[model samples]
Target chain A: MSHDHDHDNELDPFAARVRALETILTQKGLIDPAAIDVIVDTYETKIGPRNGAKVVAKAWVDPDFATWLKRDATAAIGSLGYTGRQGEHMQAVFNAADTHNLVVCTLCSCYPWSVLGLPPVWYKAPPYRSRAVIDPRGVLEEFGLTLPATTKIRVWDSTAELRYLVVPMRPKGTEDWSEERLADLVTRDAMIGTGLARVPA
Target chain B: MNRREANSHAAMLPAGVDAPVFAEPWQATAFAMTVALHDKGLFSWSEWADALSAEVKRPGAASDGHDYYEHWLAALEKLLSAKGVAGKGDVDALAAAWERAAHATPHGKPVLLQNDPSPTEGRGGRIG
Candidate 1:
């Protein structure tokens, strides 16, 4: 669909502005609205954290792949065909018994969209960006996750050139679960280190 | 789109696990426009980042971050202006023209640039 999707009576000013810009660009032959729709469609329904979930799920079951993910995330993720923009460089941070990793972009919302889809609104907001670095443990607590006192919390700041994805530890009872089933437990927040994987009920 | 249609796209995820990347259609449109522009080699991501970082750090920005995409839209416009692809004045005129066209066009009909009440009304539609 074109920018005219804002057919509602109460159109946001930004919506009108964006439509205008698209129309102008289209007139100038600078950009294509169809290409934009394809991109929007891709991010909307095709690429998302579901891709990341599969990566994490495979890592949980395959030690070699997990090692490769640590050794060279871009190549390892590419091996699974999850390669794209904003994820040119990736580093998988594994949550272990004594270490937890959290990601933030202090300057901007530099998320690994190729794997994670678009970053959530809160992820781009000031609170999460600033506090994820300043008060990571408190932030995790606010997310209803309380790590042991001895476990070290490490925060990774993402940039345009490189991004980090947190590989959450598999839930205790999911040892026998299939990769697809394990992926069902990997929420987008889990990959961003804001939440932990869900345990089987 | 309504919440149901928005959430409908997240059918791949289990219950309570999905989050909408964009809160509004305009945000997604703005985002896709930027990516599309970048894909066409209008400007490098680094340049785009510089423009965005400037807007994000603008004085008197909102504290709650509800206006994050507003800044994003501003950055896109600024970047386009800087690249000489479209200037600020041009964007403003085009926006105004679209406002007029949207009002003039009948309901359920696509709002085309030609739908503007006056083709030569703004500096934008000089080609037609």
Candidate 2:
């Protein structure tokens, strides 16, 4: 005898609830489901860490933009057109020889979504949230990132009021590299401070 | 999950990859709905944040973060009700309707609101 579970009989409460909510909203003409699809597609394809990468690469090559980013990250990042919810206020923390920056939201997952698209599952996980602050170096080590022993680790706790973007140090041997080339080296993990920018081989 | 299922799951993930961005599709839809509602000017980002933060910080919330999007959906529901959009009772009722609709829906067919066996009064008028 074969034991096959009936999928229809075992409807997930959460999925049902979500579908019900969508249906209700649609019936009320509050939201077009197509619009939701477009937003999802935009985040999946267009708006993401690549936008942050552009900002990082620009900062890498342009000293003035770097200064501007440090002074007013909101305007600096907005000037590049990566502005939206969860990113109303921005601060660019530059990772340097003496200091490394890591971002976490202990209160909640207050990620810079406009620049970073969506926060990774681990970013919102309790272990990373509670441990990133208490053991920043240890968390980095788990991600296979090891900073120099002398480098100080600074953890930024994101809140509803402000979000942080880490400006990782530009890897060596890219002196004459274009901003586009530099952007390619900026990974999502690097912007979030879990890992460093890739060093072109 | 059982050991065999866990191994299959691990096999699916590439090296160094932790987990999928969303464990399920509803999570993505819930996320998109929140953004779409905000785009419709239903609430400010700060207001949305306050609702979500409240849900996330609620006592005894899931520690593994697997239920993070559940909180997210709850926040959206709370915000919608607070804005006088859809009340809690309405959402619960509709969810029950969808549950019926899913069971009523024939296999291999889309589960639509119209498929609800006992479609509640005044809820039948929907756009597509």
Candidate 3:
């Protein structure tokens, strides 16, 4: 005789509830399910982290844009067509020789979705959310990104509707590099202040 | 939450605000369901307030965002089921079907529910 446990009975209750909700909504003709998928795909791929990278690259090469970004990030980011919903209010924090910037939403997971798209899991997880504020230097170290002891770390807690985008310091020897080339060095973590921008090799 | 607080929760938003940030497709599906239900006037704010609060208390844990949304979905379902918008039994059954669909489908592909409920029967089924 063989006894077996069926996995179908083990669907995570959370997922099950979501699926059930979807079924009920469709049956009531509340929405077209197919359309939601298309929208999800669009945000995940077409309008994602690349938008932030472009902004970072532009700031690295254009001194005027950097000044504009510092003065009025909302308009500067909007001028680039990256303004919407979660990113209606934008603040650009520049990393300097003496300071580094980090962002977190202590209340809820508020991010600049229009520019960075969906946040990575770690960003919303409890450990990163709490530790990023209490012990940012330690959290950065865990990500293998240790900053100099003298560099003051500024943690920005995104609340209500305000969101921030980090402008990483430009790597050395890239004075003549194009904005497009400079953009390649900026990573999501770098913008989030967990890691540093890559140096051109 | 009171009337004012209930209205402010992100889950109660009409629809289409931020980029779709789903830990999984089901999460997106959940959000769409709530938005759709709101558009249809299926439930009331007081009902939403009670259900959501019951499912998720507060943001005690920092990493509880995903779980918080999951509870939000659960609250939505509870409200719909209680209001006879849908039957609880049928919902459970469909959820089970999705689980079977997931088991039958290969990794990296979408797990679509099959007309045949027991799609995982026989043919190795990855049995131990």
lDDT tens digits by residue: candidate 3, A1-201:
111444343346667556645655565677678866765566657777789989999998888999999999989988998875422488999999999999986654567877887676566656666678899888777666678899999999875457889998999999999988888888776787766777887
Whose DockQ is greatest here?
A: 2
Q: What order do candidates take by lDDT, descending?
A: 2, 1, 3
- Residue by residue across A1-201, what tens digits does model 2's lDDT show? 112555654347888888878987887788898988887778767787889999999999999999999999999999998886643699999999899999999877888888888887668867777888988887787776778899999999998779999999999999999999999999888899988888886
Q: What CAPRI-style quality would you assign to candidate 3? A: incorrect
Instruction: Report how far off residue B89 is in candidate 2 (Å).
Output: 1.6
Q: Kindly provide the TM-score of model 1 when superposed on the true structure, using C-alpha atoms.
A: 0.88
Docking class of 1: acceptable
TM-score of 2: 0.86
lDDT of 2 by residue, B54-101 (tens): 898887766567789999999999899988988887777778777777
The worst-scoring run of ten residues by lDDT in candidate 3 chain B lies at B8-17
Q: Residue-wise lDDT of candidate 1 within A70-172, one digit each (tens)?
A: 9999999999998866325899999999999999888778888888998876677676777888788887776667789999999999877788999999999
Give the lowest summed-lDDT range of ten residues in model 2 chain B. Answer: B7-16
B1-128 per-residue lDDT for model 1 (tens digits): 12432343222122222346666778888999888887778877767777887888777666556688899999999888877887888777777777777778887777766778866766646733
Model 3 lDDT tens row, B60-121: 63243446566766677778778887677767666666666666666556655553247354
Which is better, 1 or 3, measured by DockQ? 1
Tell how far residue B84 is off in model 1, in angstroms: 0.7
